[model samples]
Target: MAVTQFNTEAMEQCRTTVSSQAGQFGAIGDGFSNQYGNPEIFGKLGASGAVSSAVSAMDQAGAQEFEAAEKVLRKVESALDAIQTSVHDVEEANKNSMRAV
Candidate 1:
């Protein structure tokens, strides 16, 4: 319990320190500030950013696939409606013929 309280106090102090600094969080500066301080590390960070962008693009593609599949399902439903109507008409015609006989 004492350790938890100590850690919580330390975290609040750190938060206060960060909040006092304006513009400390800038473009690509939030998580990679330390990396940007070193040129070699910054290059690796650029590559990591590219990978992150690619993953986001793939996620968009997955959403598009789901939309396309939904369109196909709607078409299938329309076709099934037509088929059902034809079947019902045929059944009605057969019933009328039996009544005539």
Candidate 2:
């Protein structure tokens, strides 16, 4: 059997990094939407169907990217919770064993 040590601090750092990235993704999405997806921009583009479509697609892509980042952040949070639970369980088991000894 291979033994693996859990580094809670490292996990926390990873979670923080992922969360910051997610925030960045959301900011980018918002900026893209504001710059290109606004009604005024569509009016200015004025019946240039191809350009409007492209801008809309880019906006959608940005939104999707932000959503993906948020999902990754959620996964990281869940992993951290699971690691903490596992450590607690192990400590409880160890205490029980010592009590019986």
Candidate 3:
């Protein structure tokens, strides 16, 4: 069998980068709401019918979309977990194989 080289360090770096970025999704989502979706955004002014409905709908959609995105974010975390597990498994397998040689 041909030996395949696994660059553990590169894999680790990629995982670290992706995980660090993924961790920021929550804060970003919250910031969006705080900045744009706050109910007080259009304070002291009368907003009704299509205008109000549109804004409300947009805000709600943003919230729901963010929530759905959070589900995807969780999947990303799970993927990282899976990657870590695979890294460990592969390293162990390589060690065992080396010992057998």
Candidate 4:
């Protein structure tokens, strides 16, 4: 005869850890947005009064550079959300199986 044991405590811990990680990811994303969400900073380069035209084009183009970083952060946050949800689902499934047994 084989004995099967379920460690639900560990599963719950994992779920908690995953939820925290997801929250951290979301916080990072929000922080990135808050820090660089404004285009005005990237819009102006050199003296404010003169507004150097020499690098004006480059300055304008640079504003969009941070957009990719924001997108990547959002993607990571979304992935973490999925992982967290999957962890919860697995925990529930295991608990159900234990109950059935």
Question: In TM-score terms, which candidate is top?
Answer: 2
lDDT of 3 by residue, 33-57 (tens): 6333444556756663446567767
RMSD of each: 25.2, 3.5, 4.1, 8.2
Residue-by-residue lDDT tens digits, candidate 1, 39-97: 34336675766665565566556555555555554455456555556666877897888
Q: What are the runs in model 2 whose C-alpha is more than 4 Å off?
A: 1-3, 34-47
Q: Is candidate 1 or candidate 4 better by lDDT?
A: 4
TM-score of 3: 0.59
lDDT of 4 by residue, 1-101 (tens): 89645455665566566556655555554444323233344467445434444345444445444444555555655665566667778878978888542
Better of 1 and 3 by TM-score: 3
Ranking by TM-score: 2, 3, 1, 4
Which residue window of length 10 is worst by lDDT in model 4? 31-40
Candidate 4: count the clashes: 0
Q: What is the TM-score of each candidate against the true structure?
A: 0.48, 0.66, 0.59, 0.45
Model 3 / residue 90 / CA error / Å: 3.6
Note the Cα lDDT for every prediction shown.
0.49, 0.73, 0.65, 0.54
Q: Which residue pairs clash in candidate 4?
A: none
In what order do the candidates fall by lDDT, top score first? 2, 3, 4, 1
Q: Which runs in model 1 stand beyond 4 Å of their true positions?
A: 1-44
| Stronger candidate by TM-score (1 vs 4) | 1
